[model samples]
Target chain A: MFVIKCPYCGERDQTEFSCHGESHIARPENPNEVNDKEWGEYLFFRSNPKGIHYERWTHDHGCRQWFNVKRHTVTDKIIQTYTMGESKPEDNNV
Target chain B: MKYSLLNLVRNSFSYHENWQEAWSSPELKKEYDIIIVGGGGHGLGTAYYLAKEFGLKNIAVLEKGWIGGGNTGRNTTIIRSNYLWDESAALYNHAVNLWEGLSSELNYNVMFSQRGLFHLAHTVHDMQEITRRGYSNHLNGIDAEILDKEQVLKKIPYINGDGRYPIMGALLQRRGGTARHDAVAWGYARAAENLGVDIIQNCEVKGINITNGTVTGLETTRGSVKAKKVGLVPAGHSSVLANMAGFHLPINSVPLQALVSEPIKPILDCVIMSNAVHVYVSQSDKGEIVVGAGSDAYNSYSQRGSFDMIEHIMGPLVELFPIFSRLKMLRQWGGIVDVTPDRSPIIGKTPVENLFINCGWGTGGFKATPGSAHTFAETVATGEPSKMAAPFSIDRHYSGALVDEAAAAAVAH
Candidate 1:
């Protein structure tokens, strides 16, 4: 279990948060202009990387706010926790 | 070596000291007619059917690690085919049929026990859902019967039907049961090898060689090998492999955990699953009470789950089977499952030509091993989706023709 650091609140138990899957997936700007294949890719396909991953998490029980977490998929080690609009962490080191 | 009474009796004379290897670990070939990427039950079974059914020769099953060491070994070995959707009903029931004769056909004792399976309904909503699915299973020609609380208590006498969540009724599938999971992999490995299929271990795939949108072969750690057709059957790592081939899959790898309690006297005879509580329990042949828990919310490839998941399931598990409250857990482990949005498997051609994929079985894959391989072998051989596999094609994601089993399947995803 992890003591996740929510951006809105301080350190909190992992159970208080809910993961919302891969983050930073920008919906296509013009949905009507995109082809079916492109729209489908945007809708269904995910990177789901095995190493470093950036995903969304909500402090559902605590602050009730959403944020992003940079964590290692293989190690389950959280590298950083930033608010929703921040860019993904640039450093590779944990 | 064909396992038989004669062989057992003859070997007994020498104190059973001389036993041949179940399968030969062959060196990677330069090229082959077909190649299977993972050496789990599905991949080995696919190779077995490719040789036995399709008359295909010169096939190789490449394993990154030892055979059956992945989800094939990690799963709790529960086998049932009472799915609600027509497509899933046909696919999973086909597996149940193949499972019946699997031991005899493989010439190995898989120990497939046809003990009945019960999906207990704890609420009125769960009762309605299961009754609807029970009727659907009957329509699909699969055996199913709804039993009231009293019947459930009579069959499973030790169950706590009047616990915190009272059991209203249950959907029972008499043909559903458990099997020896490791034997399933070894049986298929030996049988496939006997049919002239090579089994290569410790060969990790680094890249998929493609030219002009067509698959040529794979570049592995051992060496690059060529193949006319390749089937990507790797569980949990489907997205990773697809990315190597310049395509993406709608799969997320997550950890699902299962644990077994210390051995005791044989007390439980049937599999009991409570979908609302996210717990399933069955007694293994060795008397260990095997328990399955729900997946963790976040994606992971760590092959381990949070401790809270165990705590969460144990509450309802003890509530359902009060006698198990004092039993000590023996071992706990996790397997990365490649889950799809619709909670159904994907078994058909991919965007890359000559490359087929059989993945996204998620939490309920072990039950469909034979059928998944049987239909997948046909798909890879003919370079077209088999009739049974056509409904589960990757195209369905775009076309919105998904066989949504998450809603109706007894086991919670």
Candidate 2:
């Protein structure tokens, strides 16, 4: 079992957390203005990058707070764990 | 000699040393009518159908590793067509039909056993969902029966019918069962090879050479090879291969792990799946209790899962089968599954011309091998998606017309 460093709860067991899939996929500002294709892309498409992935994880069992995690999808290495509003760190140079 | 009793006896007369290789290792040709990347079950099956059904002889299947060395061999080989959606139900039902005759059609023993499959209901909601899907299956002309708690107990005597997640009922698909995973690939490879299809192993595709939005050739580890058409059946590597051709797929490659217990007497004769509790178990022909669970929460291509995942799944399994608490797990392995948002597959032409892809099978591709290949071959052959494969086009994502099977397929896959 790996540990997830929740921005609020510090390091905790993975069971305490729940993944929220790929991150940085903001909702469209105005749904009425968006076309069906754009709306679908917003709703469905994801980077799902093999290397570095920016995802959201909620410390549901612990702090009940959600945060962002920049982890490598292939290596499972957490490059950084930041708050929900913080921009993704540029440390995944590989 | 053919794999028959006469050949067996003939080989026995010579100390059983006259056996021929099931398939040939042919030299890669400079160019082919079609080049199928990834020599897994789907790729080999596509090649087999292309040559056998479509009458396409100049075909080559390129594998980065040996055939069936990927998800094809790693899956827990459960076959069922009791999907929730009509499109999926129809597609999987077609696959099940093909599987029933695959052994005879291929002239190879694939060990297709219809031992039945059960999806146990752990909650009232689960039972309701089962009832709903059973009705859907019925409308699709698929065989599905809702069994009460007593029937589940009768079918699986060892299961703790009254555990924390008590068994309320189950959805039984009597025609669904298991097949020897590797044999599916080998049978297709051998049959495809017999039809003059090249099975080139250890040939990794490095780059896709496309000109004017049309696929021209592929640069491989062996060398550059040209093809008029290309089919990508690379499973978890679908996104990676698509990236080479300047396209991105909404596919995530996640590691799905499964384990097998040591050989023992057949405790379970049929497949038992608990989607609510997240565990699937079936006894192999060799008596090993095969257990599989949901894919790891995170994405990974390492072909391995965390110990926490195994622990999480084993708890529900052991709770259901108290006798298996002591059964030692002999082996554990993982496969990278390419999951799509809809949890269904994408089988049609891509933005690139002369390039077709059949992937996004996610956690359940092995069961759909034959039908996937049969339709994929037609799609590649005619440069148009067949009636069976038309609904699974890539444009579905944009059109918001999705075959959503995510919840139903979650743990059961």
Candidate 3:
């Protein structure tokens, strides 16, 4: 078990935390309101980028709160970590 | 005179009689109202809820080993409701709600800490996924954001930042978090015990006690336990237990592994997951960096997590976070995961009457603990499936109603 630092709690084991998926995606209201075409699109599509990328995640085992993180694909270096409502990073030519 | 004596005791209604029946031995004691298989979080949690919610007294949770000793205790303890599928998203959203109140609701400490999680994207198409998934999440009342380079660097800051993979942006869930797996199990066990539920550890179900395709009880390593209702909550061993009942489930047990770095002053705060890298990383409160990846491509119940997974992950892991190279490896191990065709859980009734199942929890079961238990319990007590959890039923495979979570833009992408 690796030690993960909680933005709220101090550094703890990875066992004490859970990883949410790629961060920062919004859901629609009333799934029935959305057409089957949209629903199918929502279920089958994902951006499997190759380099540096952005996504949403949650620490299910840690603070139990959802947050955002920016990480690199080639290096795995977490470039940025932010709470919701934070502005997105400026577009950069990677 | 005997009748008069009986009436005299009845007349003494002011006090209740302590007619306690003592048992001979733990090994010899058998016979329970409910015999639940599997000791993972779902099984133990089911036992807790059955007694607490449904008032199903005389319940026994039979674990082959110890409580929480299975995947319920071994997984990367994360929870979220950002699923792309409505059947799953709605249910998991409810699970997040329960996780919010479980500590106080159970009157036991679950230590559910919501630290948020960020899934990194490395391409342009990934951005579109984030947008689409974000829409679905909003529909389910969950929020996810798209983050760009500077913002990503500002929060994480330890990246190579070269963006060789064209780090476009990410889907962010601000409410997801983790909890202690062991504590989660212990809390439920202690609570279930207090409610008179028997947690029989080290007891394996050797034989199925069934009557004409319907389960009457079970013959375990300890002894025979007769129950009117049964629930097979075993995750990895789900197929095995299902075989015992003369039925087949579409589940394969795969070995999933994870490793941790030695304790160091924390560097990362938020949990990081990358489908491109196929390695997920997060730092715990104790300073160890827990790292995990997908299951081994082989089929086996072996609990020995192979070095192949760890060594293979280094390429992506280091690529994402170069500084981890300096970190020392502490421990590495594997847990058996029950995989389904659609990567969804099987949490409803089987063809066998009175024999309910809550298995088929593939790689992503830990997050679905509360919701799995809530619906599974309802299925067992009432012999009816829950609408919220119905999509995950075993019947779906036969009926062709699969809940594929492949889309949702941000999940497992």
Candidate 4:
């Protein structure tokens, strides 16, 4: 149960939170151009990397706002937990 | 195990509701040897064990509302022990063991059943995780097996099996199942009440009267009550009660919503979970298809089941159980869950003397009732945590020793 430090609400339990997978997966601008496989992969595949992972988080129990978070997958540590509208994460930090 | 860890975990006491115990009277008995708050399963179960196992009586259980009125009654009423981690695996297995014998132990039918639980997986990764968890739980003495799509189809033909959100594989456990939620609570309540523990209801606790860093007693709706020991089991409302005592709890409260389709023929035998959809389903004994979704990120005390939640949960349900699309939506409700930073529950003592806590069940609380209550009672009586709970102490969070339960607490659980 990682205690996420929501920027809006103080630290909250992992249960009062939702994890939106792989924060930087942008949808292809041309939907018709992407094949069915690519679309499915984009929708289904997520990096459950053992190391640092960029993800979107929602403080469901407190603010009800979605935020971007740079979290460690292996250690369950929140490197940086921020709100939803943040810019795409820099992969170098991960 | 470090005794300090048990005492410290209560520090992240995510108590959000007012301490409104419907039963309290200072003048009647100045002080009892022990006090257990929140007369739900854990509190009452603690008293029962204290008297039967520890040879201790004179216990009091105070509840603001009727027994099992909290998450105990609100939960979807399912139980399983397939876990990836060692600490949680053993603990839940022990709880399942207790459930096997609980009907005879309580001498009242709690409607306990071992109808089996099947974890549905859509992708190879989910199947691998299930395999990992299956091995872990098996090593911890749980009975688990792997099932392919053909086996799943054989078990319940009603489940949809298209390549879209296809069924890659599953983790089947014959030992895990559900019981009557209200009956389980009432069984514990009546049994504990009969054992001479003051099962006080309609009593609200307002404040914990302390002095010099010691828990003297508590001021409640009825009156002041003194006690040598106090345990809080307020569930989602756990944080607010902790605040009155000046405890800095790290947990936040969230409303977890669940809905049921109108009564249909019982199609699902074992529990069903969709890793791709993040939705799980199981039909109750009453024929209502109980479905739950992950919590919506945000804080609101409201219990109104959202349209968005239905839409989000339904997408997974229809993909998995096509029959559910036509089933009329029945009653939908929400319960406040006291979630901990690490998806695991904080079930131990507090820093203050004579003050013990058992909040932070999150979504994992119901599956852990027997073991949690057993070890929690042991801790409150002896002021030490059991080996099973040593890893989940609240102090670990402060010391960067938090138990990462992302793999364990995922909706796949």
Model 3, residue A69: displacement in angstroms? 42
> Candidate 2 or 4, higher TM-score?
2
Candidate 2, clashing residue pairs?
none
lDDT tens per residue, model 3, A31-77: 87976545543443223233455645456666776666565443334
**RMSD in order of candidates:** 1.1, 1.6, 16.9, 14.2
Global CA lDDT computed for model 4: 0.73
Order candidates by TM-score, high to low.
Answer: 1, 2, 4, 3
TM-score of each: 0.98, 0.97, 0.75, 0.76
* lDDT per residue as tens, model 4, B312-343: 78788888877678888787877777666667
Q: Give the per-residue lDDT of model 2 (tens digit) for A1-94.
A: 6688888778888888878788888899999999987887788767667688888888889888889998887778777889988887785375
Range of the 10 consecutive residues with the lowest summed lDDT in candidate 2 chain B: B404-413
Top model by lDDT, which number? 1
Per-residue lDDT for B1-413 in model 3, tens only? 11235755875684635422211113424577787887777887888888889988888888898888888777777777777778888878888888899887766668788888877777767667667777888887897877886777788868655644745666778788788888777777777777787778888988887788789988888878788999999877876777688776766566688888899996887877776556778888888888888775434566754444677666677878888888888888778777666777788887788999988777888888888888788788888887876778776765568887743433332
Query: Would you list the C-alpha lDDT of every candidate in the order shown?
Result: 0.92, 0.90, 0.72, 0.73
Ranking by lDDT: 1, 2, 4, 3
DockQ winner: 1
- CAPRI verdict on model 1? high
Q: Candidate 4 falls in which docking quality class?
A: incorrect
- Which 10 consecutive positions of candidate 4 chain B have the poorest summed lDDT? B19-28
Q: What DockQ results do all the predictions give, each relative to the true complex? A: 0.83, 0.63, 0.02, 0.04
